[model samples]
Target: MTEFALDAPVLVRPYTARRDGDFAVIGDDSRQVYLSIPAEGLDLLEWLRDGATVGEAVRRFEATHAASPDADAFLQALADEGFLAPAGAHDPPPDAEPARARRAGHLEWLSPHAARRLLSRPVLAVCGVVVGVAVAMAVDRPGLVPGPSSLMFHSHFWAYLLVVLGIAVIGVWLHELAHVVGARAAGTSARMTVGNQMYAIVAQTDLSGMWMASKRERFVAVLVGPLVDVIGAALLFITLWLNDVGVLGLPEPVRLVVAGVLFTSFIRLLWQTFLFLRTDFYYLITTALDTRSLMADTGAFLRNLVRRVLRRRLIDQSGVGRGEMRTIRIYAVVWVLGRVVALAVLFTATIPLLWFYLVRVVGFFRGDEMTGQFTWADVLALAMLSFLLDGGGTLMWLRSLRRSSRLRRRAPDRVLVE
Candidate 1:
């Protein structure tokens, strides 16, 4: 049996487990870590904490629980999970110890209930959109006509940004509420958290617990936000149409607010649809593939393949289960094909746009000085620099394409079965 030392004070927290009775190691605010071992494993864990080596711990376990078999294997498994660190390195420095021990408990349950309550019905969601759009129109403009500037001026740019941001926050919260409502309809639970610092907002469904549920349920949950966006867009279009036909006069401020909300809502929907960005679309793709752990496993296998191909030593291969490895192989082939197709399409579409823009900039620069705001030389220089930067980025990404290709060879499958 393999034996490892618990020498480090810091241990890896097990976030996911495949079986019950698995231990969860959590660090405390005071730099002390607690191992929530299974009742059966408690004595062995305690013995190790009491300065016992692996062999001693095993011996103590054998003496205490004679019926327990495979003591050595159990100890090794504990070591692997990082419940025990190597003996000598396990102690934290006295001065630094308290800080290490002070760990905040996971707040997974924090907004689930409120989120559920707020997102329970289709009628309510429809009403929210109607009210949100009505409020936007009422506060901003009477029609599509360009209104007087509504931009607020303040001593601090941050304060102005904050005001605009408040509106954005309301929009985002409504977006999440869409998901919450969808999940509720499908009888699932969801939680929200600050995902990335850029937005300081995120909503996540603990749908991992519902992996075994029907695909229809999963699809409904995934489609909720996009559906909400669609409704919002439709409302905006109707508002615009009404204003154009003179059915109702909208103030300029109200018009601007509605337009802005519509634009942002569409953008949010588009963002979620981009599967490569690992947004809601990514979850949908994964669900379709029926491989719950597709991302983690495929990533591991691809890393291993890259290392092997590049003549580098292989690191952790533990995460890639056999089924995942099979999926990875299939994914790799499909991924390469997809990229080839994408690259071709991007070149065909983007190249012409780039060339047209380049020509415009050149013409703007080279035109007569009297008719032009800027000299030809300045425009030409800026245009050339922009081209060079764009070209450089494209080239860099192209070069990195081979690595991406290798990685994609293990892309998640597009369809999954129940």
Candidate 2:
């Protein structure tokens, strides 16, 4: 394991200022630190860089300045956040060169191909229409076919549930496929990874080569999945309409399957488009802002700000240019504010839904009611599965956020500014 030391000198880099009074540091490995501070806080950073230890820095400041005497605590805090990793720990790891070499020739699966042939555009369009008609028929003719008898229910419910779950899984796979296809159409190479225990898969396209491409191409890549989703929904809707009108004559089970597939696919597409969830919308925002790593950089800035505030030391102002600083300040404010709002919304809405589900599960366990209308065994199974799915998704999102943050912190200044 790599361990950072505590006694290394603080590495002070060049400085720049933002319109909103935030400071930026340009350092080795192209790291940029955005410092939010009051006017007088700037001098404190300069004093510390002049070879002052946490205790000595504080004593020197107290000799003249009137801030709190918690400078030692503050310096320790910075050291923890990697902003001031102990001096000798800065070298690259021994395995880094080997890892780079191994990764150099990796082949990405989602490379550009003749997608128009593989997808069979006409078949997709027609099948989409058929699925829509089936859904319409099911909704309009509800209970036209009787519910399963008690014996049939006990015998076949498990099987039916498995089929439904299987369809759901397929919907997710198709969702990812759409992304891969879109990236390929945009002439980017992508690879899919079964991340975090097979619950979530990510289709990552190597668009580094396309950075110089026109904005239209970039936007097209982002828009592809959502557009395919819309097409699927419309087709499903049409199929439902046709079935209701007695034109397609689809069976009841087929209709329900179509409806379920359509509903799940459409919702997943909508979820991915939600900007707050940091889905495809998040990527779109980053591309539009021309900042490859805004959220990560903003998070780093906030972490640094919190460190300085805890230490009661002056904030550092240095390194970034004026326009870059302004952009970062705006991004930091928005990121902090958005997270607060997101937490509030999740608490108010998501928590209630979760509580309701829990109540149903408990009721089933007590045999008071047929919670979720599932057997106790099935209920336990579903609960465990859902817990794994939801929890895994959340963890993956958080990890991605952290990885993106670290990448931003270590990225070239040009990448951030662009």
Candidate 3:
């Protein structure tokens, strides 16, 4: 790409426009790009579209507003965001393509109107009441609270693993479906796939398109999944309570299966709290803070802080504002502390769990019969469960690095920009 003179005409891509508070949003429905900018930025774009040079637009902006804009910063930002290009540059670079994900587009029948009806105030109120009552009862009945040991209520380990896994699969579908509903209500769509966090397997929903929606809609879309999880858990608890009180006569096996679902849902809720692990809450935080490159900026903040202490060369924060940088400074503490806690859990709990199953399986292979309370069924189930989660998840995590490499090579799934 050849550099052009500042006096040459600029090209602003054709974009649909809307007013969002103090910002003007210009984007296309084709998923080309979306930009949220100050109101005057729209004027700048219009001027450029009318064949004005960068210099002329800058002067016009100052004259109209009685304040000078950051000409270089403004142009650089536009260029980087694919809004502006040099004279006669009609085509984007072959490598500069949008990263498209395969969308299953599940629940196509649930139109925007249907999603709104499902998420209406009445429905939400009923859900809230159910959850509130469930919580009140669980506070009194300590048995309702699930723990790691709650995973095995059945005598047969295979029954336990199978039911728990089936429940988990359904939970993932429901969770991602909630996100899709939220997206539809916000006048868009999303997709879900089996994805992995840095160290664990997960159900990932691509709400990348929701960046164009209002903050309220984005909040609804991201937070609604957890909300649905809570509702599901509440229903499970209430059903169990009914059985306990003899209002319903659920058999032992059926009751235990419901408890497994409750436990999986509980773990899913807890997983969202690890915001540093690229969970939904992380998306909410980034959206709220108006961060374009939060993880990247946080890394830079930590790197520069260490350099300042060591009297070494510092790195640029890459266009982060002072206010945003300050927030990043505070969040950096939370990020580091969260990671430290994760490492502690890994070394203490996770590693031990891995070793426990590994050693037990080895013992059984060395002509050691399954004796005592542990049967061959128990050994097989535990070994397979541990290997699939620990071993398979680690493999997926490694494979995710390759996905990250592909991401770096393609156009970014653009987040919001101030």
Candidate 4:
């Protein structure tokens, strides 16, 4: 541990700070980390950023609160994390560019300025009306919604692959684009990137700047991803309804493709509902409630609960801000229940499907089944399903576990919040 020099000028690196209820959310873009601190801590950090010496800062703190702060440990932690530097040092460079520029498929030609203009009041009004009408029309038409039989229909294996992959690609592209547009609409900037989310690679929108935006702005930004999904699903339902009523003459293959799109939309919407996964809904809820550290706080609460039960040394919970405690307690129970239910569903529904398909794949190869009913297409589909649900998933999980193990080994003294 380096001792702090009273005369040395220490300054905080550049960070974006915003008020969240009674706390401040300070984002260190250089390190891709966000820290929440009480008002007193924020004041101390502000003084440090203004080139305050250790002795001067401590004197100010004591003068303000009539008691001295533990400036040594706190300042050391900031210095260790690269958030503090010598007064004459240049601004630290960010580890990653939050806003990335890339070709957004057909929307590549759409400039940021154009996106903002296109999502303006009149356009938004028209969209709202269209969405409202589509929802109303889709309500009485249950066939507009896809079913398991529709998804399981025996189509050409290549066609199935093309349809699912195409819909997923386009859908994901649109989903992330919607997030960017939403942020821009809120007068903030956002960027798109592809990264590993949980088990799979997926598109992501970096809306870290939303911390500085108003609550309504943050809500709009977070809500748009799921809104885009629902609107997409609704429009697909309308198209299916139109096809069913013969109002729009369409080929059988095209109808099937449309059905596939609707099916994908439903699945996407359902996935977004899993708040336990820190999905879009999770951000929406947390932002709405002004809870800055829901996940971390909840995990801490749970660990302390278990420690208490075991009569072991427990981490103090008093450090958590007052506004966050209730939300963390509620979210902790929900998180536990969600994990249990997810595991239950995995074993009961997913594992059985994977095993059934795997057995069929084997039976297709064996002469005992006579391969008459099960064609090569069936075998191919079953094999792909098994690979995705069993092999691919297992590999991803193992990779994540190994990565976590390495991190833990490298930083044995570090404590993981969750």
Candidate 5:
């Protein structure tokens, strides 16, 4: 990118702007790249687009806005982003290539507008119907949901587990797809790819464009993934009810397997409610409240509190805007409460169950014959469960600790600008 003199005028390439709540979403329509800008920034862009020199635009912006604009930095940023062209550059090519994500590669297979027009209303209706049916079934049956005893080691225990695992894999793939579908239904571009989340490799649906969407659209986009699981769970529960009430007689093994799968769906739905983890419901809440960065800002507020308690230099919090400050504080309390509940469950329930199974397996291996309802299959199941639960998590914590130490040494408690 060549540097431009303040006196030299540059052409502001054609773009589109739409109001998104408090901010404005500006997009280089030809490139399909979008960015959110403050009102003052939009004004500055308009001034530049109207043939004002950088210096003159800055003067005009300062006259209307309180702060003096950083004309040089702003212009350079625009030039780098391919939004500006030299005085007579013939508009540079209309499709000069939008900025792309380098991390997880993706392909947008569906046209957002087309998909929204086709699926939004119908899908929403289906979701509503499913929820209503699920509630009615639950009310009638009263004991429809599966329990731990629902899992039984029959003759085909391994086969059942393998099949259930396959269903779980399909469910996860559908989860990511649901996000893409939902985003498209809300008229936002979305793409799918594999990515890391909290050290686990998983499928990700990139909904970066949702920032420009309406609040209702954003809420729908976030709710759809969990709604997918909800619908699945509802259908499964209905099946269970039919089987139990003799309306449809399924084989005992078949019924058990369906129950197991239904249980998986229920767990996935429950996990979505863990807002501290930034699950679907968490995104919905943030969108509803119009918070800029709920999780990140809340964590920052908590970190600043700790620093204050320690009488140490606080992290820079200037990036958190006035509108977001109150939300962040409220979210901080919720975050803390959620963490406490999670830790308590982990220690009191999950750890104890894991320990019981692990101890039984270990004792059997140490010259103690398996007894007390424990079998070889039990050992295998417990071992696999432990591997799934603790395998990468412990290692991730160690790696994170090491990275945190290094970051602290380089810049202790510095708040990063996101």
Candidate 6:
């Protein structure tokens, strides 16, 4: 802990402090310092705001309240969050208002007013009607949902790759754009970037600024992404059904392209349900429950539990709220189960896929007798898959680690949550 003069007045950096349920939320949005604290913690910030010394604040709090505030711990807590300024400063420090996040500069045109209109109830209702119509059509047609046979685009492989990949890129962009618009509607900033979820590349939005927004607004920010994605995918399905009945009389290649889009879209939606991976739905859960960093806290809880069993120095989680801790404890079980399921699938599917492709490739190089048929195209596909899984995933994971290290250089992940 850094030493502080007990007699000197403490100056707090620019922050917005508000009461939420039984705790106070204090934060500097630009710096991404958000945390929930008990009443005494709020009182301490109030005292410090009025130019109270650490020793003076503690004495005053103990004078009226039954609980005693730890002077050193109090200062350390604030310092941990970068919430403090130089002692006895006449004004808030020059760096109180830091620069905003590295958001998409192109989205400056998307104001809160525009975002609100786009996500308005009327607009949502219209979209809901479109999705409902699509669903009804699907029920009648029943073939709208693409299956395994739909993925066979062998001769039109290049076109399938171009069209499907193009649509996927667009879909991912739109998905992340919804998150940004949602945050903007809440009068907060957001950043969109490419990231990796374990091995697979993913696009994500940094909606940390939503912490300053109200609970209802936070829900909007998180849910908008998945909601828009589902609706857009439904519309694509309807388009394919429209073309199927001689209304459009599209070519087989074109129909195959649409089928490919639908296939991937459905799979993408299913992937979001893997809550252990902290999908958009995970953010929705965290918002609805008003829990701070539930995923991170749950991970820490499991880590400490193992450390405890090993008689090691367990890391402290005392800063987490009691309600949040309860949720974390339950989520810890879900977290473990979810990972087990994911690992089971990886071992079952990924291993077989790897083995099948690898052994055939080695057979070709060795000029050995082939058991099953092999082709250059098959080798090409295998090489691409290997590159994406091995090389691409490794690079992406390293990038994610570097990003986390850069953003969190000043404080621990605990600083953002309760």
Best model number under TM-score? 6
Residue ranges of candidate 3 with Cα displaced over 4 Å: 16-39, 67-77, 94-98, 101-105, 139-142, 286-293, 309-315, 318-322, 355-368, 399-418
Candidate 1 wrong stretches, greater than 4 Å: 1-3, 6-84, 88-112, 122-228, 240-246, 249-277, 287-293, 299-330, 345-418
TM-score (C-alpha, index-matched) for candidate 5: 0.76
Q: What is the C-alpha lDDT profile of model 6 across 62-127, one tens digit per residue?
A: 886867877686667666557885585454344333434444433757889999999999999998
Total backbone collisions, model 5: 0
After best superposition, candidate 5 residue 349: deviation in angstroms? Answer: 6.1
Candidates in order, TM-scores: namely 0.45, 0.53, 0.83, 0.83, 0.76, 0.85
- Per-residue accuracy of model 2 over 1-418 as CA lDDT, tens digit each: 2342334455544443322224222222223223333333445556556765545555566777676554444444344333343344564343221111112212345445664344556755775676566466557765432232311334345555556567767655565566566556555444444554112334333333334334665676666666666666656656666676788999977776566556666566656754533466777876676554565456556666776777744324343446656777877766667667766755675455456657767777677756445666665655655555554555776786676567655542213322
Stretches of candidate 5 above 4 Å error?
1-18, 25-37, 45-54, 70-100, 103-107, 152-157, 186-189, 192-203, 319-323, 344-369, 397-418
Question: How far out, in Å, is residue 418 in model 6?
Answer: 13
Q: Kindly give the stretch of ten consecutive residues in candidate 1 with the minimal lDDT sum.
A: 409-418
lDDT of 1 by residue, 1-418 (tens): 2336433232322222221223322323132333233444666655656566656766666687685546555555455434444445454332221222233322334354554455557656765777577556645654442222333322333333344445656767666666655555544445444332111124443343333235666776676666666666667756875776689799955655555556556567766754433468777777676555455455556566777898866655443447656776776665556556656755785565568558777556576332434434444544554455445546655655554565444432211111
lDDT of all the models against the reference? 0.51, 0.52, 0.76, 0.70, 0.71, 0.74
lDDT of 3 by residue, 1-418 (tens): 3343668887777666766655677765554366667778888889988999878888899899999887676766676656667888886433343524335565667788989888899999999999999988888786867677777554786777787788888887898889999998887767777777665777888776676778888889998999989999999998888888789999878877888888888888888888777788888888788775577667667767777898876665544568888888888988899889877876787778888888888887887766667577777787787778766776887787776666534523232221
lDDT of 4 by residue, 274-369 (tens): 877777988888887877768766766787788789887776567665657877878988899887887787678767777777777776668445
Off by over 4 Å in 4: 65-67, 86-115, 155-158, 184-202, 355-374, 402-418
> Which of candidates 5 and 6 reaches a greater lDDT?
6
Tens-place lDDT digits, model 5, residues 99-199: 65434213356666765764567867877797788788889888877876666655656667767767877887777777877777666667676543343
Best by lDDT: 3
Q: What is the lDDT of residue 273 in candidate 2?
A: 54
**Candidate 2 structure, TM-score to reference:** 0.53
lDDT of 5: 0.71
Count steric clashes of candidate 2. 13
The candidate 3 region of ten consecutive residues with least summed lDDT is 409-418
